[model samples]
Target: MIFWAIFGYLLGSVPFGLVITRALGLGDLRQIGSGNIGATNVLRTGNKGAALATLLLDSGKGAIAVLLARHFGGETAAEMAGAAAFLGHCFPIWLRFKGGKGVATFLGTLIALCWPVGLIACATWAVTAAVTRISSLSALLAAALAPAFAWGLGRPDIAAAAAFMAVLIVIRHHANIRRLLAGTEPRIGRK
Candidate 1:
């Protein structure tokens, strides 16, 4: 379990947003909107391609960790790995432990843990984002719904993991939540 967690953390700590943006000479991603090392902030660079790559890579790290652990050590190891990956994305050591909110990693971990529940959460995020044009809101709603979705789908293990990640995501989004309540949160594609 510890080994899988360490493995997941190392993979998740790659900081793909910073990597992709810098690779494209877009300057330091940490200085961008939200100062977050995530796809949403990557999009602020006005490079959709870079943003998409960051999203895929961030999501891929979580998924890969879960899948690898599951294949080698079973469900418990997979769960530990997934949670560690999400934490790693949120507080990566390479970034002085200040990293992105774990939305993409959470989604990827959920998808690998249970596809049906994961699909439901993803669809919820898409629909919410489409209707509200608020990335943070979409993520919050999806993260909030994940545990319920997993419970409904009869995956308590997934529900537990989703619940844990949901709490972390909400904590990370404190500023976004305040801005949202103030009706001052930035919308998608505005940057």
Candidate 2:
């Protein structure tokens, strides 16, 4: 389990958004939009294709981490791997502890660990984002409901981990939360 956890961390630590931008000569991703290494910020680069790729790659890393651990170490290891992956995405050593808000990676982990909870979370995010047009709010609501869904589905361990990840995600969005309260948060399609 420890080995899988470490492996997961390493896998999740890879900042795919940053990589994609740099590879495409888009300049430093940290200098753009929110300075975040997530798909949202990648969108600020004005390259929809890059943003989409970053989203898929970031989520894929999380899913692959859990799948790898499960294939080698069973369900318990997979659970641990999921948590580690989230942490890695949030505070990657390679990035000097700076990382994304965790929505994509969290969803990826949840889906890999438990598809039912993942599907429900996705649905929640879709509805929330569509109605509000605010990505951060949508992610927050989906994350908030993740633990409950896990618990209801008889996966207390996953519930606990999801709770932790959800809280971390909210914390990472502190600035956005303040803006939300001030009615200054930006919508998905706008700057």
Candidate 3:
């Protein structure tokens, strides 16, 4: 169990977004808009390919870790592994405890537990992003709706998992929330 948790964390902490961005001559993603190592910030570089890769890779890490845990440690282990992966992405040791907001990681975990829920969450993100053109807003709203969606689907465990992920995401976005309330939050594709 401990080994799985550690492995999940390490895997999650890989920071593929930073790596890919740097490798593509885009410099460090963390130095860009929002200064976050996430897909939204990666998009600030105007490198759509890099942003998409970051999104898919981050989500893939979460999904792969949970699936591995499920295969080797069963349901409970998988849940624990998912939680660990989310944490790893949020507070990666390699990034001096600063990491992404964990939205992609959350989606990955949801995918592992229930692909339908993951699909719904992804749709929520896409639609919200399209309508509002605010990535942070879209991510926050999608995460906030996840628990309710899980409950609606009659999955208490998944609901709990999503709730925890939502809380973590919200906490990570505390600064953004403040900016949002003050009408100072930057919109997507903007400085």
Best by TM-score: 1
Model 3 Cα lDDT, one tens digit per residue, 41-97: 888899888989999999988998899999999988888888888899999999998
Score each candidate by Cα lDDT: 0.93, 0.91, 0.89
Q: For candidate 2, write residues 16-125 as lDDT tens digits.
A: 99999999999889898889999988988889899999888888888898998999999989988888888898898889989898889999999999999988998999
| Candidate closer to the true structure by lDDT (higher is better), 1 or 3 | 1
Ranking by lDDT: 1, 2, 3
Q: Which parts of model 1 have CA positions greater than 4 angstroms off?
A: none
- TM-score for each prediction? 0.99, 0.97, 0.96
Error of 1 at 111 (Å): 0.6
Error of 3 at 188 (Å): 1.9
